[model samples]
Target: MSHPMHDVLGRWKAAFDGHRPGAMAELFTEDALFQGFGPAVVAGQDAVRAYYEAVPDDRRAEVTVLHTYTVGERVAGGFADVTFSDPTGWEAKVHMSLVLRRDDNGWRILQYHVSRVAAGG
Candidate 1:
């Protein structure tokens, strides 16, 4: 059976597919922290938008939810498997932690952390 986490994940993916920064921003809180590809920390909607925009065209990820759990309106925790081809034509796999909140509207991500996994190194 599908979970609430799936709904939130779908919303996040939709934001990415549409490439709508404003829509993506709406999916986060005012003080959300998004740690993307690099080590830099992106906070708030504007910063998140800028960070996402900086992603190379070829650096698109397809995320698959491996697990998820929800705790009240304050938090939702999950791990996802992320696979993508980099701009340099190399495939990469990443493990992502998704943290979101549920308000009157719906779930909004409070934090998103993606960590790259070394391949057969």
Candidate 2:
């Protein structure tokens, strides 16, 4: 059996790898705050959808969960290492952090942030 973190990230990974931007956005809350690989941070599910819509269709991501913690009955947060690659062998890595909240709809991402991974780190 998998934990909530795995359940959520597993779905996220599938959506991202499958190039389903809309499905990716569905993983977040309506008021989610997102800072993807872009320089700008955006809020709301609409913006999250827009941000993911810019991802290259051939690009896929592999996320390794580094840590996760429960803040309360309704909140949880996690850290992960994410590697993105395409068919051409181009790759990028990032340290990702996320906060999720539970509602009647299970867990939804409330905040998502990513930082470029340093060389040799």
Cα-based lDDT for every prediction: 0.79, 0.90
Candidate 2 weakest ten by summed lDDT: 1-10
Best by lDDT: 2
**Candidate 2 lDDT tens digits, 55-76:** 8999998999999888878998
Model 1 root mean square deviation, Cα atoms: 2.3
Candidate 1, run of 10 with poorest lDDT: 52-61
Q: What is the per-residue lDDT of model 1 for residues 1-121, given as tens digits with 9 covering 90 to 100?
A: 6666688778877777656667777887888899978898879989887866765544556889999987875688799988866658778788988788877767788898898888774
lDDT of 1: 0.79
Using all chains and alpha carbons, the TM-scores for the candidates as numbered come to 0.83, 0.95
Off by over 4 Å in 2: none
Residue pairs in collision within model 2? none
